[model samples]
Target: MDEEILVKKLKARDQKVFQDFVNEYKDKLFRLAMGFVHDSFLAEDIVQDVFVKLWQNIDSWELGNAKLSTWLYKVTVNHALNVVRSKKKTSNVVDISQFVRESDDGGIEIQIPDNEKNPHNKLENKELAGILRKAINTLPKKQRIAFVLRQYQNMSSKEIAEVMDLSVSNVDVIIHRAKKNLQKQILKLMK
Candidate 1:
């Protein structure tokens, strides 16, 4: 079904709508949380908590003003941020030992694909995706959240500002810094 119909059903208090919503976005939400937490298990737990929060608050959710996906994105971002913050309080530096591991053949390669548009560039693109994911993990909390919402989640600056509870200019600044940081990290990794 179309997003509009699914959301309308949800707003109409359909019980099964929440299940459909979870099924539709669970993987994406989990990936998003993992982007921040960097631990698959913790990320999965966070995604579940986010959905529970959504289900509990669905009645008060104003599906009239925004797309359900947008709301979901906001919720996902906020939940991921909360996880990041809480973990920070309890653990200052999260270990990156999990994200980095040697392959049977060799170590990690950090390189950008030259011909990204080529149909046969899938392998190179996958390598580049890995490098990009690594680069994202090194970003600071605000920059990471801003970049993820803007780039991966396909959210505009205004929407990110709303999700992160920051001003539009703050979102813009964070994204700019994030891009610069990403570039520096990519270059450092390539060296």
Candidate 2:
């Protein structure tokens, strides 16, 4: 269905349309939430909550102001950030290595080349992935969000700027810094 028609149905409280909408966006939203919280259960809950909120507030959504997805992304990011902040209050230190071992990759899968399928190479790839995950988790909040939206979500900088409420140039800078920081962190971890 077209976005305009979907929005109309949603605003009219069409349950079927809402269900379809949830089905379509649930995984994307979950992955986005996971990128921030790094917990599958929490990410699931966050996605559910976001959908519920959207259902309740559908009429308040200004259709012409922004795309529905941009609104959804903004809400998910804010809610996930809130959860992270509250989690931080209860624990002063987070063990990045522990999370790397236990956490999901926010729906991202590491792909090994066919020619590099040796067991030893596979092990090295997994280790490198873990290092990368840890480095990403350590990034500053804005940088991490920007990087995830750009890299994992494959959103354009303009889309990210809308979701993050930043200028396109600002989003670009954040992503750039995130890459630089991740490189430094990865090198440090390798040592």
Candidate 3:
């Protein structure tokens, strides 16, 4: 179903529409949440909470010049940030390495060059990917969100801006800074 139509139906409290909406966006939302929180269970809970909030506010949803997906992304980002803040407040430290495992089943796969026939290349790419992930983790929340949404999620700058509630130019600036920071971090790691 079209997003507008689905949203309208969603507002009407159509159970089938709700089911289809969840079926369609559940994984994407989960992946996006995981990208931020890096905890599978927490990501799932965050997405569930987002949908519940959406359901509760369906009637008041103003898709004004924004796509439903964009609104959903905004919601996901807000909730993910809240979870991160809550964790920090609770003095619980999260290990980045724990979320760096192989994404073979395709939940949060890092975009690394894969050469099955060449062990050397694969190893090199895997090492680079690890360094890249570390660098990404070191970025500020906004920069990290911009970089990951652009590079990992393949969202355009405009979409990222909408999802992040920033201007398009601001999104570009954030992405550029993120790249510069990542490059510096990777070079430092190489040293």
Candidate 4:
């Protein structure tokens, strides 16, 4: 079924369709939540809470001129920012690009450390991922979202703009600044 039809069915209060919607998006939503919250347990809870909120507000929903996924992404990002902001200190950091697709099952999987590898190389790889994640975490909200959607989620600038409710030019600027900031941070780390 096409997404539009599925969404329409959901809007019409078809309970089965809602279940299908959940099945279709649960993994993607969980990944997105985990990307932002950087905690597996908390991210799972966040995804579930967001879905419950979506169901409760379904009756009031008016699917204006946006894709369902984009709307969902927007809601997810907002929820994540709220969660992070509520923290008094110690923001969460995540290495989103680590979740790469594997050929065996099409599952999102990061590279696992080889048991036979020397400790030093393993430690170095761990340090690199950490440094990269730190640089990404320090990005401003808009830039971070734009960069993550673009780089990690493989979303086009147009899709990111819709998800973020930003102009295409603004998205371009965010990407530019995000790359610049990441470069500067990487250089700082290397020094």
Q: Which candidate is the best by TM-score?
A: 2
Best by lDDT: 2
What's the true lDDT of residue 36 in model 2?
Answer: 72
- TM agreement with the true structure for every prediction: 0.58, 0.71, 0.68, 0.70
Give the poorly placed runs of model 2, Cα more than 4 Å off: 89-134, 186-191
What C-alpha root-mean-square deviation, in Å, does candidate 3 show against the real structure? 8.6
User: In candidate 2, where is summed lDDT lowest over 10 consecutive residues?
Assistant: 89-98
Better of 1 and 3 by lDDT: 3
Q: Write the per-residue lDDT of candidate 3 for residues 1-191, one digit (tens) a residue.
A: 77678878988899988988888889988888776666678889999998999899889876565787888888887888778667632111222342244666876643443477655664555455455545666788889889878875789998898788899999999999999997887666644
- Which residue ranges in model 4 land beyond 4 Å of their true spot? 2-8, 88-112, 115-133, 186-191
Report the poorest 10 consecutive residues by lDDT, candidate 4.
Answer: 87-96
Minimum summed lDDT over a 10-residue window in model 1 is located at 89-98
lDDT of 2 by residue, 1-191 (tens): 88899998999999998998899999999988877766678889999999999999999887687889888998998998788777642122232342233227566343443545564655444455555556677799899899888776889998889888899999999999999998887767755
Instruction: Write the candidate numbers in order of decreasing lDDT.
Output: 2, 3, 4, 1
The count of residue-pair clashes in candidate 4 stands at 0
Model 1, stretches more than 4 Å misplaced?
Answer: 1-5, 11-13, 89-142, 154-173, 183-191
Candidate 3 residue runs with Cα over 4 Å from true position: 63-65, 89-137, 183-191
RMSD of each: 8.3, 8.2, 8.6, 8.6
